[model samples]
Target: MSMRSPYPDVEIPEVSLTEFLFADGFGDRADAPAFLDGTTGDQLTFTEFHGLVEKIAGGLAARGIGKGDVVALFAPNLPQWAALFHGILRANATVTSANSMYTGGELAHQLTDSGATTLITVSPFLDRALAGATEAGLSADAVLTIDKAEGHDSLADLVSSGAPAPELTTTADDTAVLPYSSGTTGLAKGVILTHRNLVANLLQVHVMGSVTDQTKIMAFLPFFHIYGMTVMMNQGLHTRATVVTMPKFDLEQFLSITQKYAVDRLYIAPPVAVALAKHPIVDSYDLSCVKTIFSGAAPLDGELGRAVAKRLNCTVLQGYGMTELSPVSHCMPDDRGDLDLNSSGFALPNIECKLVDPESGKEVGVGERGELWVKGPNVMVGYLNNSDATDATKDADGYLHTGDIAVVDDEGVYSIVDRVKELIKYKGYQVPPAELEALLLTHDKIADTAVIGVKDAEGEEVPKAFVVKQASGADLTEDDVMAFVAEKVAPHKKVRVVEFIEQIPKSASGKILRKDLRARETEQA
Candidate 1:
């Protein structure tokens, strides 16, 4: 006999403008610290967390940002990032996440795209965020500030002056959050996650993982990303677990926080995993209590995983997800009885996973490689302004086709073999050459470069580079650029062809336009 859902037909929960997550955990633990901002030593107990959200929501309600209105959060991973985000949803309104590092041009695009009427930002980034908002012709009705909104009325002040949240009703299908993602072929598109979608995914993780009251987790990941929003912030809130947060991924700060909080569960990305595996500063921290380190966002090399586990003596479970699946469809928890490296684990309790041919819509046979498709309450409602894109990704049969190519083994372990869209196809085999190109561009006297797949001697495709050199100081040659990239990317993905260009075109969201590069090469050929 196997365990199953009590309400199989029941859907995910939506934003109901009344109950706070902290109160849902327990009234007794209401005063328990939910977030500790390691940067400022500021901590918010569950009582304060709920109270602030109520006040913020009340204030927002006063401003007429009710159901369906969008609010933007352009702040770091400080304690207030959560309050404002959850508060916006509490009013049955929508939320759009923006990176604090975005330039005015970048920020304006998203603000206008989301039609966000309210812009909530921290003080340090206020000037840039406000400039962008103003340039976008968006003067937020409620300009709430975090710790330092340029001497403006802080979120704290608004929460204090406003009344408690008024009861409002909502359904599970109601849209709650709008987090953006750079899809397979386009710029960043808003991922509209309904309350049910988010709640369902979190519930899946809650059901599978062993998050007890004793759970002391580290929250260094940005609050903007779906992975951190659901797993670190939301998951910790409901479980009555204490989460120590770091606004930025500073190795020294991370070390200090672990010592301060005696952190247990660590969640990080591949880049951070590199630091854990190779950096010497980590040895200074007492990580004996650390039971698990969950890695995701990008692929983690099996070698790096082993190195970190050997050094830290903690099981590193690499989870897999995209912004579309409410951020997580599978969890390879460290305590997973018998899971191997590179295996992203199987579908969580309520999810249905399948494989489909990338070129055709037909489902592939078992053990065959194909696009990983997912179906569950956690799947997003749709892309905000692109119905065609939404329909293309999500099939009529209800499965959302992830552009990632993977093979599921008989043991239920899912390992991503390749990213179909992110690939730089050379000959026939694809190459993921990202940091390799960035490193090449950074070599002495090189200005900028973009490595793309192009035809070679045997009429087989190989990597080619378009490099722009610094005009003033150095006379950089095409050979110099090729050698730089050759040292980094694999032989097949090495720059066999090189051309001088004035600029390497990129999308608005900063991703390189490899298709445009391929077209340029064909034009030259």
Candidate 2:
């Protein structure tokens, strides 16, 4: 039987995202701070952020970028990124976010796949952005550099022209953002999230007391990731909260900024919580101002989460979701005295979830371990350009097959047990072996490679590569294989273990025999 959220259904506004955010009487003070640059202390008030969004929207419109146009936003967390993202939406264009750490080839795949005609990136990531734009058949003029520099125009230049805002022509069902995800299988594909999906999720989370004007959020999570895009940046803006932006995560910098800004709400991953629970440096900083720590992106060790909360004297909570579910479906309540730290909390206000036997495809009883299926307004419209994948993931009945094995207790709280998919989770980031294997095949030394996740010394799942080297590359060491992949992908996705094999186990249909390798790994352990 399906379980509904304990809270009553909320009335979601049918307006556009920008309209919802800039609506009248949303916040008490329009001049109050909305965002701040953690490094430079640069600030944008609510009123200013709104006007700049309009100006940038106008600018993009003036440049012939409007409804149905696709723009790629590649940047780290920054104060202006909020404005830039909303501006793209205000122009009624879809913004596909590319991870800032992506190589030119990686970024190019997204640009070409998403059909993004325009690329916006900061000065640091300009080289890859330009190369990606070229590879995607875009001209240099199509690249808009965020930093105002010679030869390249910046976001400032676009906003300075002061073009009038273009008319918004979009339906709630139109795709707004195309964040890529490697759905239960295969390579990364664009998750088609409509405007309604995003707004519904924001409201669902808001009704749960996740964010408000009193929330002083620290935006350290990469905005390129959907969790940061919706939870920290969008929710912070929708509530008119003060968000302190960090370009990247550096433990020292994180503590310094959080303390300096008196940040009350921290949207973090489990790794950060682990550090706070065990790291000695955490005691050096006074974190008394912090009230709530919302952890997502991966499973949190209940003991570790509670330990961190005890040390900081704050409420540490865990939530669960994926890119396909608008990134948030279950979250712990703010008052956490009665909830289980291991549970992912109750389903959000409009979401319904069920535990179903994977093999039987029948609904499971309470406390039974089965794959989790969720149905909600926040579910993605579909996978872009891939109807087969869309059909495989979301059923005609609208329930999304989440591939995650979970169990619900008598109280209706859910706990994720394992993933039925081959994707590896390195500190909460999805690392698809298919994507990595495809990249590894291009390496000169590699003849064949099959990647799988193995538990590291830290009890974390990391990509381990079983490789077949070319005769000429017999001297290739494990370090060589690791470095070869490290240069191409993000840090968390780097190969941690390497094993040389003469033949790769596979089926007659050419599917990787991962079960055989997993059994071998179990024997070795």
Candidate 3:
């Protein structure tokens, strides 16, 4: 049977993201700080930030990039990135976020797959972006940098242009963001999140967390990722929260910024929680300003969550979501005194969840493990250009199969037990085994290869490769195999462990028997 959320339904506005965020005179409050650079102490008030967004949109329209165009945004967390992101939406264009750490080959795939017409990046990432854009058939003029470079137009030029704002003609169903995901299986595909999908999720989490204009948050999570894009950046803006932006995660910098800003609500991943629980450096900084820590994008052990909560004397909670759900479907209640650290929390308003047996395709009763199926207004329209995948993920009844094995208790709290998919969770970032295996095949010494996630010393899942070396490649070492894969992918996708096996077990249909490998690992342990 399907389970519905216990909370009352909320009215989700059928308007553009920009309209929903600045609705009912929220934008008129010009004196409130919207975004702050953690390191530089630069701040942007609400009026200034909104003005820049419109100016950038006008500039892009004058450059022949208006409605229905796809723009690739490849930058770290910064005040300018936020302006540009909304600017694209203002022009009725879709923004596809590119991971900041991607290599040339990896970036090219996303650019080509998303059919991006223009690329926006910072000066430091210009070389890779230019190369990837060129490979994806975009011209040099199509590449724009946030900082002034020798041959590229800077973001300042765009903002300073006196071009008139293009007429707004956006619909709630129009695609807003095209964040890619390796859902359930295979290579990355664009997850088409429309304006309504995002707005609904923003309101869902806002009411659940009781977020308001007074909330202070940190933007240490990368804006390119969905969790950060929706939870921290968009929700924080919608609620008029003071956001302390960081380009990347540095423990000392995070603590210092939290202390400096008196940040109350912190959105983090499981790895940071691990550091907060075990690292002595956490004791050095004043974290008393932090009232709540919401961890997502990966699983957090119960003991680790309690340890951090105990030390900080604050609420440490967990949420569960995927890219297709606008990144949040369930979150813990903000006011609860007694917390179940292991439970992911209740389904948000307007969301319905069910646990179904993977093999039988039948819904299971509560307290039993089954693949999670969620239905909500926040669900994606579909995977772009992949009808088969879209059909496989969402059922005829409209539920999206999450591929995460979960169990729900009598209190309606959900806890993830295991993943039904082959995707690895490397500190909350997805590391698809198929992508790594395809990369491994390109190495000259590799005759055959299969990749799987193995538990590391810290009990975290990391990519491990089992390879069959060619007769002439007898001298190939584990380091050589790892180095070859690292050059073409991001840091998190690198192979950490290598084992030589004569053969990779596969079924007659040419599917890798990952279950066999997992069984062997368990047997060895």
Candidate 4:
């Protein structure tokens, strides 16, 4: 892989995962809370966290777990989650994070795919994880429990054994993490992210002014998801920031945490942004403490930015990335678009981005729309055990072709103008649904919007949109909305058709479910 960047001063760490964070900056930091488990008063300091990692590492070592082994972490954002992550890395093993909300079927597929031997999970999910493991043909050696370990060993107890850090030499290039991603058009595939990949993103995110030791970050996003895993958990540790975690995202709990910790940073999705911009409950808490509020997993509306900025008086920054790139490709710079105003901003300092024509691999003109291509050390090594998909995504020159259609000007500001596959193709021309969707969100009257293409009788496709009106019982006709989009976009880019619904379907990661919406259209037809 090419190891050069536009900015020559970019630095890459030459240390192991344990050494990079725990060994380097961990001096007399035991007293400070390393993690605050919001579900309970369980807080671990740097010493405690490090101690637990050693114990878990020792336990895994005793069980013959060694270098290059894959471990499954099947739980939510809790103390044990982080412990398992570090412990697996400490044992020179790879960690594959699984979404806690997944059913046994989903869990089975990932477990089978990653070829995991050991699964560390919470007590509440032990039965499900075990059932999933058995079904997936995993001969489980250990099921490290999170809380109650009546029949199993508690993760805390394993770490509290007072076991010291084990003697081991590891490399940053050794694969440390295995995150999964559903590509632009396929079932989910495991992503191979080395310590270098994760650490690179951590370093880039740090250099991009992500957060610091002084920043109080509210961790409501699910750690199982890459966005939450990298930003909330790993970034917090790398930066020595206080992570105020939530077991789950409750609007009241979210605001309470904000007021409780005087949170300086928050990484949210579009739904939470909607709540912040419009939810009446937000007014009760003082959100002025937040210096930076980031939105990912879904595209954010700059118009919502205007509304939220008016209320919070903070920088609302957004960037576009997926699990394939350790989940973050950019952080809206404090200077980009007048300081986190609009646009996803330029690629990270060490990251290279180019706009490429979807059909042809040719570069597009500056400010012209094309599928965005990303290349950086932060990009995942490849999809785990799926070389075909990996080869297709990452080109010969190391560029990870992001499926998003974007426009980049000379200023380095990139806007997610449309999606390559997600866009609506009218006749032969392309229609940026995001443009129409953003316009719809700006209307104080409309709440939710999703645009998808449905096949016509002539075997062609037409743009059809489904809307979720904000006000209850509001009478909105398709023609009225069509007129709104037609007035804003080109003749072919017009909505053409609209259907009002109670809600718009979205993924747990916060992306709009265009496929689900298309399925709805199929059902209707």
Candidate 5:
């Protein structure tokens, strides 16, 4: 049986995302800062932001980029990134946001796959951007920069075109953004999220968060990820909050910015939570202004969440979603801080979820674990140009098979336990790697860790841990590491193998890159 959200459904506007965001025209908050650069202290007021959006739209239209055309945005989080994003949409074009950490070849895949005719990026990333454009069969003329470059048109050049903004022709059903994702298991494929998906997620999240125009939200997560695109950037715009942008994460800088801006709401990944909880530099800053720290992207350990909340004297919340769900489906409400920090709270309004036993293909009752399937307005239409992949993930009934195993309590709160593909099996017993990884993180000597299923000499699959030890823990032995986890977990879930690494490989969004670790093991084999 599919379970509905405990919260009442919120009305999803039929207009485009831009229409839904800018319809009221800023009202009395026109002069308020919409985006603030945390590094340089530069800002764009709501009025200026809207004007830049129009200018960017006009510039894009002048370049023959309009309805159905796709433009690639390959830049870091900046106030201009937000403007250019809206500008592309305003011109009735779709935006394919590429990961900032992507290599030239990696970016070429997205450009060619999304059929992006133009690429926009900053001057510093010109090398990779130009290389990607060239590899994707695009001329240098197709490349533009956010800042001035020797031979390229800049965002300023776009605004100087003086062309009138095109009329809004996009509807809620039109594709708004194409963010690539590997989904449950596979190589990355473009996820087709429509205007309705974006708008619905914004409205759905609005009912669960405490953000307001007066709230100062810190956005360090990459805007290219759907989590930041919807939960941070667009949500800030929707609520008229001032978002402080960080191009990247730096420990001391993050703390300083939080202090400088008196930022109240922080949206981060679990890795950032680790730094907040364990880093000594955090003690030097005054984070009293911070009221909440919301974590997503990967499962946040409950103990880590509690540590950060206690140390910062603030509320810490977690959410569960994937790229296909506009990246937000379940989250703890601001007022519900009393709930378990481990659970991802209730489903957002208008969502229906079912937990089905993977092997049995039967829906599980509350408290039983199964793969989570979601249906909602925020769910993606499908994978772009990959019907087989789409059909494999999303069923005929509109339910998206998330492939993440989860359990629900009688209260309807959901806790994501593990990914179906990532779970380790030991002697016919299922072992969730996340549970072991989370347990390992609680050890003082372990800075970071990743757990994966590796075959032993007997050809039996067993759990192995790749650990990054703290600087002070150089003398800590592998036996000590295994023993630490062994004492807490069942025999089937023991970390049978341990390898000390300098760092655990992670994606920009903070998910453990288990495939990379597995490849390393394969190379050795």
Candidate 6:
């Protein structure tokens, strides 16, 4: 039997995302700061942001980008990023957000896979963007920078077109954003989030959080990730809250911004919670204005969360989500700081969840661990152009088989304990083992390798590789392996730990038996 959300279902409108967010207008809050650049102290008010959206839509339309075209955004978190995102939607186009940390080759996959016609990035990332665009068979002319570049079209150039904004033809069902994720286990594929998927999630989340126009949100998290896209960026807009943006996270910078902006609500991953609890520098700044610090992306340690709450005298909450579910399914409400921090509070309204024993294929009673399956309007339509993967994840019955093993208490509070999927979450970022395995094989020193998530001394999940060294690679050191991977992938995806073995455990089908590797880690620990 499936357990329904304790909260009553909220109605989801059938309008497009742009219409839902902008059609209502800002009213009295038109002149209120919608977004502020924490580093530069630049801001865009609600009225300015809305006007920019129109100009950007006209700019995109003038550039021959219209209904059904996908534009790739490869920039850091800036006020312009939000405007460009909505502008794409307003022009009846889709936005495929790329990881800002991605290497040229890594980004090329998304650009090619998403079939993006134009790539927009910042001047600082022009090298990587051009390299990716070139690899994806796009000419340099197709690349546009958010900032002014010597040779390429800039955001200023786009708005200068002065063309009238095109009509919003996209329906709620049309794909709005294609954020990539390694669903269950595989290379990252684009997750097809329609306008309804995006809009529904905002509505579902609104009921659980206490964000209002008076609320100030600090967004140090990357905007490309679903957690930030839905919970931070769009949610802030929906509530007319002021969102302070940071290009990247720095401990001092984050603290200073929170204090400077009097930010009340903070959306973060577990890693930030670690800093707040243990970092001594956190005490230098007054975070008294902070009301809530909500952690998502990965599980948060109850003890650590409590420490932060006690240290800052604020409420600390946790939530559970996957990129496939438009990111949020279960989360602690703003007022429920009394609940166990380990448990990801209640399922959001409009969502029905089932915890089924993987082996027995039966619904587990309260207190028993099982794979979490969710059915909700916020769920993605499917993976883009990947029917096999879609069928594997979402069943014909409309339930999305989230490969997370979780247990719910009598109160309907759920806690994720293990994962049936092989994807590793390193500081809230998905690091696919298959992608690393394939990359590692290219090295002559590595014969066979399997990667799995292992807890470090700090209790953070890092990628650990079990390798069978090539006979010629007897001198290959762990540092060498780490360095090789660090050079190729993002910082979070680097192989932090490596071990040499005579063989890697494998199943009859030649699949890497990661469970055996995990067991070995346990025994060793």
TM-score-based ranking, best first? 6, 3, 2, 5, 1, 4
| lDDT to native, each model | 0.74, 0.89, 0.90, 0.76, 0.90, 0.94
Taking the tens digit of each residue's C-alpha lDDT, what string does model 1 give over 28-111?
A: 677778888877888998788877787888877877778879988988887788888888877778899986667665678788
Candidate 6, 1-525: lDDT as tens digits: 799999999999999999999998899999999999999999999999999999999999999999989999999999999999999999999999999999998999999999999999999999899989999999999999999999999999999999989988999999999999999999999999999999999999999999999999999898999898899899999999999999999999999999999999999988999899999999899999999999999899999999999999999999999889998999999888889998999999999999999999999889999999999998989998899999999999899999999999999999999889999999989999999999999999999999999999888889999889999998999999999999988788899999999999999999999999999998988
- When summed lDDT is taken over every stretch of 10 residues in candidate 6, the lowest stretch is 484-493
Clashes of each: 6, 0, 0, 0, 0, 0
Candidate 1, residue 129: the lDDT equals: 75
Best prediction by lDDT: 6
Candidate 2 lDDT, 442-508, residue by residue in tens = 8888899899999888778899999999988889999999999998887877999999988889999
In candidate 3, stretches whose alpha carbon ends up further than 4 angstroms from where it belongs are none
Report how far off residue 316 is in candidate 1 (Å). 1.0
| TM-score (C-alpha) between model 6 and the true structure | 0.99
Candidate 1 vs candidate 3, lDDT winner: 3
TM-score of each: 0.81, 0.97, 0.98, 0.79, 0.83, 0.99
Clashing pairs in 6: none
TM-score of 5: 0.83
Poorly placed runs, candidate 1 (over 4 Å)? 1-25, 140-142, 423-525
Candidate 5 lDDT tens digits, 1-525: 899999999999899999999988999889999999999999999999999999999999999999999999999999999999999999999999998866686689899999999999998889889888999999999999999998999999999999999889999999999998767655568999999999999999999988999999999888998988999899999999999999988989999999999999999877688789998999999999999999887778899899999999999999988889998999999999999998999999999999999999999999999999999999999999999989999998999998888999999999988767675545433466776787888999899999898988845678899999998898999999988877655465689999999999999999998989999999999
Residue-level lDDT tens digits of model 3 in 1-525: 788898888998779997887655555457788999999999999888888888999999988887889999999999899999999999889999999998877889899999899999999998899889988998988999998987888998887788977988888999999998998888888999999999999988977786778888888898999999999899878888888899999998888899988998899998899898889999999889989998999988888999999999889888899999998998888875366878789999999999999999888988999999999999999999999999999888789999999999888889999988999989988899999999898888889999999999998999999999988889999999999988889999999999999999999999999999889789988
Report RMSD for candidate 1.
Answer: 7.9
